[model samples]
Target: MATATYQNGSLSAASLQGFVLVGFGGGAQAQALLFAVFLAMYVVSVLGNLTMIVLITRDARLHSPMYFFLKNLSFVDLCYSSVIAPNALANFLSSSKVISFEACATQFFFFSLLGTTEGFLLAVMAYDRFMAICSPLRYPVTMCPMVCAQLALGTYCGGCLNSIVQTSLTFQLPFCSSNRIDHFYCDVLPLLRLACSDTTLNELVMFGICGLIIVSTTLVVLISYGYIIVTILRMRSRSGRHKLFSTCGSHMTAVSLFYGTVFVMYAQPGAVASMEQGKVVSVFYTLVIPMLNPLIYSLRNKDVKDALKRLGQRHSLVRDGSQ
Candidate 1:
């Protein structure tokens, strides 16, 4: 841990060379339990996301705009989950939860990049759904392969830019002495609190940027769903409406779970108790959501379920032939 030189009286006491993450502390037994739980969740999340990606690639039935987005989403979840879960699990097992400045900064950067990218990707997925439902005839033309590729690329570019600004702005602040970060990961708000310098401008800028991303993407999702609803209502076939609702419902559930926890953790006003609450909520969005996404999509979607079944039967036949 290389310490920052403090010149003048400007540097506050909270500045430090490295940070100690005092994660959800319970007794040793409790930490052990948490480690087991998180380890299990991590394994499951990776496997689940990988399975979805493989299914999407191998199954011709899933080769559509919607699955394209889903494949990307699964990839994001896999990478995002990897960013935090392994380190967190290690901290739970190790006595010292210390992270050097460079490592922490790197973690923060990737976390923000992937998370912001996923947000934009979800909005794009909603638009894909809207076009599919609201304009079935024109959907093929409107959401061509080129268009889908462009949308996906745009989300990645946007997320990278957002993260660069945020990570640079955050690490530019001086930390005087306080090396303790209360949260599990190197999140923005908790890191901001440790800054020795005035963080009003930083906070405001971060809030503005995050707010813009969240609000704009959310509006796109809402508008897409709004149009989708009107179109569904006008349809004569009940079964067709049911199918549309089913697809949208899975996406809506995912969006709600993700945005709901994120908003609670970052956007809302906090009480002293809210910090504790934020940790729990962060676990859900950061760890649990990634695991749940594949399950939600697979269970709700007939196409995925069918693909899984075919995959299983094919494997069984291969095994029997070897016998």
Candidate 2:
């Protein structure tokens, strides 16, 4: 872990002892209440995402490109949420909310990588849906298993590159002003405020990279859906149109929930100014959204429901035979 060093009456990020995350400060009662709420949420997030992963991986019926993407999405949700929730939950009950310099950097690195990767994956999913709906015959060949794996790999690579740049720029500066992070977790925006030196470059690069990721992916989703909608409209069968819309509906909802919060949090220029709002927004994206995704995908989809039913039936059969 990089220790803080003092030089010339200033403390560089390396010289910093650590940071105090003043997470949702109200009082003992408020902290306790929030602790309970967030703990429940974290448990739900873990269980729901795990169930999705288990179901997707075990069930033969969910072997298509869409579920393949959905499985990865669940895994990302599982991972990225774990990166934040456990840390935040621990802080809620502790008297000291201090996190070491290296620890903070690690949190930001994984969070950025996983979160950004999900954005790219979601866009990839949109393309998958577009191909499935608009060019059904070509869909299998184009989105072959090899191609899908490559696309998933590509998302992680893009996210890693983005994380490297953001983490490098944000942490290399002097954190002499204060060792206090105003939000729940160690995000780039909050950390940027603590830098004593000029962060013009950091802000610019963050805006540029984050903007490119969000905007480009969002455009992919929108354009894909536009084509998907047209194709659905032209379908002569009512049931076919309904099924197509249903298939895309879950992805669209997930995209909307995930992307909207991200755009406001990262891409919006004024985001850093409001720490209180940032905390709420951060909580939503980090905790609430992950918990919601599995429910959104599963409740609205017939295949997952049937898979769950089948899995339950098989378990029951095994139990009865053993008895």
Candidate 3:
């Protein structure tokens, strides 16, 4: 049992050492099955993102603002997937499922940092598309290399600031009751349910901050896409319109997969018992989205395919020379 104290006429855990993560419970067979499934996904996500990063860095053809932002996005997806997968995968096989306060906070921190940054990066990508399609003449000067670096930096900054607030606010609450987190990993909603005292401030902060980030970034995407659609329609060449549409379509698919779950997870009252349903939503964004992003972009994008082909040919030539 966790040690507790009564302060301000309420219960609080003065010496709450840690929490027990009550992961998705099941039989041995089920656990093994889940473990295999998640392990495969984690491997694919890591490999795919790493390949995208290497290809973008190695290929001169991908040295553009679009690919620059994409490289950063891949980096985020890679780390974001890392923050939770290994621990959860281990727990699936091990009997001990305990996590200390500090460890959980660290997990929450990086997850929040990278995930939030991705939203901003996606919005920036939408704006990049808008400028490239709508204002072809000044696209280069407007989205110069230095400018892309600054934008990427800004996304990280935004995510860091939000994460600071979220981590501090969520972890500050006193956990007086059971120290069980009913989720696969440390998450805001599940942890909030464990707070012993009134969590009015926590609720408001979570609601307000989540709303601000999601709404603002989503607005940028929507407005940028609005102009992109108009510009694409005005293009005379069917081939040109089709190419532009195809590229923009990939971004839209990723955005929908990401924001749809976030809106459902954080946009509502996290304290509600029903929010437990967000497990599926959380899995999609954290696991499935990262694994699918590289596929969506590489398969749908002609440039990425060409770069892969070129990279393969170079490898083959080196092998033949060695022989």
Against the hidden reference, what TM-scores do the models get?
0.95, 0.97, 0.95
Whichever of 2 and 3 has more TM-score, that candidate is: 2
Output the lDDT of residue 112, model 1. Answer: 91
Backbone clashes in model 1 = 8
Supply candidate 3's per-residue lDDT for 262.
83
Query: What lDDT tens digits, residue by residue, belong to model 2 across residues 174-241?
Result: 87746889878899888888878899999889888889999999999999999999989988999888
- Name the weakest run of 10 consecutive residues (lDDT summed) in model 1: 7-16
Q: Tell me how far candidate 3 lies from the true structure as C-alpha RMSD in angstroms.
A: 1.9
Once fitted onto the true fold, the runs of candidate 2 whose alpha carbons sit more than 4 angstroms away are: 1-4
Per-residue accuracy of model 3 over 1-323 as CA lDDT, tens digit each: 34556666434544566778888878899899989989999999999999999999999999999999999999999999999899999889988788887889899999999989999999999999999999989999999988999999999999999999999888878885578898889998888888877888988998898888899999999999999999899889999999999999999999999988888888777433464466667778899999999999999999999999999999999999999
RMSD, every candidate, angstroms? 2.0, 1.5, 1.9
What does the lDDT come to for candidate 1?
Answer: 0.88
Cα error, residue 6 of model 2, in Å, equals 2.6
Error of 3 at 224 (Å): 0.5
For model 3, state the Cα shift of residue 257 in Å.
Answer: 0.5
Top-scoring candidate (TM-score)? 2
